[model samples]
Target chain A: MSLMDKMLALDQRIIFALMFIALAFPILSPVILPMNIQQYSRDSFEFADSIPSGSVVLIEGGLGAATYPQGGPGLEVQIVHLLSKDIKLVFFSIGTETAAWTVTAIDNALAKLPSGVAAENGVNWVHMGYVPGGESGVAAFANDIRSVKTEDHFGTPIGQIPLMSDINKASDFAALFWWGGSEGSIPFGIRQIVTPFGVPMTGMCTTNEVPNYTPYINSGQMIGIIGGVRGSAEYEYLMGMPGLALGQAMATNFGGLLWALLVVLGNVLYFVARREGGAK
Target chain B: MQIPMILTAVIGLLMIIEFFFPMPASVTSLNVTLRSFVTIISATALILGTIVLTIFHTKKVGTRGSEWYYSIVYVVAFVVTAGLGVLNVRDTTFLWIYNNMTSPIGAALYSLTAFYITSAAYRVLRARNWNAAVLLVCALVVLLMLIPIGAILFPPVVPLGEWIRSFPSGAGFRGMIIGTSLGIMGLGVRVFMGRQKEHLGIREERRDSE
Candidate 1:
């Protein structure tokens, strides 16, 4: 076999090894790569910034373990940004497996807060945990949030929570921030809250779901989107705080480059092999 | 059959009215109650699914087939996890299992996709035709634009990628959403009319020859 044939038929195990190196090297030795801030990421950051201090925002943590690597860091960074601005937040989920993730993100974000800033549950923030019934539950929650969530995630009565007293419905929220790993929660925000109540919304989605939510951004339905790993890196940059998302920036760049190179090399080798075969 | 159909129609109609119309407090209260009922039903369905899963795996373990060891593992894991969860006996043990074992295993499974995608892209993404060639170029451009190194090296590719995503990809996605929404609307209408009762597990009883 010629060089082109060998290249085309390169062992997959070799490719896997290369991919492993590409992902692991940067992760082990972190690189602070320059991230070009996309409009969507900037928009998302600005929206979070624009929220008036003391106003409440509903954060939907609609992601699970499967999408944790893609969406978790961004969620934590967004939480940090929200808490830093002193905007009270209510974290809830339509994704059933999101409660543990919400707790971890809240803990991580609170731990990283600037000096003298502290987060007190039922005062500054409240977690309503995972609400069942998917879209219908979302609709009901939007209509009368307090009614749907009579108790906080910790089983504290909503009436007892100071923050809960201020938020009666979806309209009371300054903005709706949905950190979704899958495409499940975006439409609910649009249909249930934004369209009906005219609330400003922002979506933080895994990189793959960016396109699905982009049209909504274009249509002004979503104020902005924190798209994928790159978007998360940009968000951390804008906040002047580096976290897991920013740390993974180099790995993302390296892995992406490796894949792009393989695509080019694979095509090149295919053509070369084809030409050689035709000539014979 | 008739009772269920009538009940579904009433509830569906009420929801629709509650959504579009400015109904009174009485009707709105009923709407909220109905929504809560749906949530409760969904929660119960989850429990039912877990029970079904446990039974299925238990039966597999009892059969002692070639893959029965995996079934035993599943059954053990489920029983232990469920017991720990119900008891809330050892919070640290539960969290440790979740954070260390479950989360890492789930993340590892998700990460494996990267290797598979790279391998698949190399072997499968061919430019045999003009359309395929365009797709290949578009994909490469988008990939390059998504990465930080690509943006730093060739800045123009960033806008090009955004444009591609915004127009071509966005338009395609919009079309799909429209198509899907229409189909869902049709299905909703059928369900409301009791034509799609089977979807709700209300299948017609058929007498069997056996």
Candidate 2:
């Protein structure tokens, strides 16, 4: 076979090996990536920064274990930042079994924070648990938070939770942060909670959904956004708390470069083989 | 049929009714009960999905397929992560799997898309016709706008990119949203009225006499 033909017909195993090596090498190295911090990440951090101490903030952890790598890190950083500012947080999950995952992420993030920076659980923050019905649930919460969330995830009544006592509706919270998956409770929250109540809101979404959500950001419907893990890293960096997010972004960037190299090599081999065979 | 769908229809009707008039305590209690049932059903579905995935991979490995090793890796990872998860062993093994295996694999998988995109762009941007040329130009413009080099080429392209996103692309997205909304509404009405029999896996037969 011609060189180009042989190159074009390269074994799938070789390609896979190359990819593995490329990704593995970079991941093992501690190389900082030059990432463009979109306005959304900055705006999201600024929005969190602007909130006064002890202000009420509602965080809807609208993702599950499957999407942890993307939205999970962002949620972690946001929680830490909020905790550092002494913000009273009301946590709830809107997507697939997120209550458990949200709790885990919160605990992990709090543990990673500098000694004594983490908020004391149940005192500074309370988890209201997973609310079903998507948009309908958000509408219900908007109308009357107490009516929808009768008790905390652990069966503690809302009236008893110190942070929840001040929050009766969307208007009560100083701000809202929603991390949304493709099909989650955030759309409903945007329509019902933020729009009608005029409560400032921010979102952390997967990178694929960033383009679609930018309009909401520009329209003032959403105050800011943290798009994917990169956004999470930026937020972590801005907070002066380098954690999993920074590591993940660096790994992702290295992986991207390696992937680019493989593609270039593969194409060059294919073209060279083809030229030698006089088929091009 | 599934219990969840039945509960959904019944509760949905009641919810709509509650909107029009005051619902009694019994009706409100029933609605909450139904909501809890749906949540339980969804959790069960998640478990079922995981089981199905495990079985599929296990079968592949048992059959000694070309990628049997990969299937073995998949099962091992799945079992280790899930087993630790179920046992509530969150600190050591579970967290290690999450931080090392899951995180890196997830990042690698997603980052690979960038390579595929470049290859796809190369093949798709070939000059074939006016439409193709227009498509190529627009794609390049958008691609350039996405990268930092585009801003260096022309600083105004940033705002222009923002304008294109908010105006033209946004209009297209809105059109899609409206179309999808209409389609969903139509389907929902049909299903609600019990006219969409396909969901039941039953085909209607025309009467010869008619």
Candidate 3:
């Protein structure tokens, strides 16, 4: 076989191995790459920032650990930013297994909070656990928070929970920031919260799901976005707190480059082989 | 079949009315009751699925056919996980198993997509025709837009990628959404009218003849 043919026919196992090394190297050594913040993320940050302090913001956790590496950091950073601003958070989850992820994120954010600031569970913040009815459950929760979930994740009554007293329905919240991992919760949020209640919404989704969300932002349905690990990194940059999201974003960029090179090389070889009649 | 169809039709109509008009207290209560019934049935269905899976795998293991060891593993994992889950669901052991065992397996399985996608993209992303070429170029641009260095090197690539995603991709997604919504509405209508009574264990032909 010609060199181009040989390259074209290169074993994909080798490609996998190379990709493993390329992805692992960043995790081990970690690179701090420059971030060109996207306007969507910036707009999301500014919108979140604009929420009047002391007003409650309902944060939806629609992700789990399977997407934690790529999707969790954005939630963590957003939690930190929201908590830091003294915005009382009422976290509810519609995705299965997201209740745990929500608690983990809240813990991470609380650990990093400034001295004297506390994410007092059931007081400053509360997790409503995994609501059962998916889109219907979300609509129900929007219509009557008490009926959908009478108690927080800890079994404390919504009436007893200090933060819950302020939030009776979706319209009572200053804003809604939903973090979507795999299940795209944006449409549900739009239909239930944004449309019926007129509450402004924002989202942070996994890397692959980011492209699908831009239309919502363009249409003014979504006020801002934290788009995957890259969006998470931009958020960290804006927040001035560099952490896991930054590292993962750098790894993602390197991984993207490696894939791009492989694609370009593969195409080049195909063209060369065709021209040489060693081809096609 | 008749009763289920009547029930479905009545509830569906009520839901539609509830959405459009402010529901009376009795209608609201009925709506809430119906929604709760759905949630309960959904949970029960999950339990049924678990029982079905256990039986299937347990039978596979008991028969001891070739490759039955995998079934044995599955049965054991399900039992232990389900047992732990049942015995104080918030127990540290259950959480540990979920975090250390289930979560990692799921995450690892998901991560495998990266390798498959990379290999597949290399094999299939070619300039075979104008359509293929356009897809290839758009893919490359979006991939570049995800990278920080690419954005820094060619700033315009950012907006170019955004434009492609916002217009072409968005239009496609909207089309899919509209199509899916119409299909769902059609299915709902069919089901409520008893034309889709297979799930109720009644054959359509038998019902139609009756």
The lDDT of each candidate is 0.82, 0.69, 0.82
Candidate 3 docks with a DockQ of 0.57
Ranked by DockQ, the better of candidates 2 and 3 is: 3
> Whose DockQ is greatest here?
1
Give per-model TM-scores: 0.94, 0.69, 0.93
> Any idea what lDDT model 3 has?
0.82
Q: Which stretches of candidate 1 lie above 4 Å from their native place?
A: A1-3, A276-280, B202-210
lDDT of 3 by residue, B128-195 (tens): 78999999999989878888778876778899987888789888776777788799899988987777
Candidate 1: which pairs clash?
none
Fraction of the reference Cα-Cα interface contacts (below 8 Å) that each candidate reproduces: 0.75, 0.07, 0.49
Per-prediction interface RMSD in Å? 1.8, 5.7, 1.7
**Per-model DockQ:** 0.68, 0.15, 0.57
Which candidate would rank higher by lDDT, 1 or 2? 1
Pairs that clash in candidate 3: none
**TM-scores of chain A across candidates:** 0.92, 0.86, 0.95
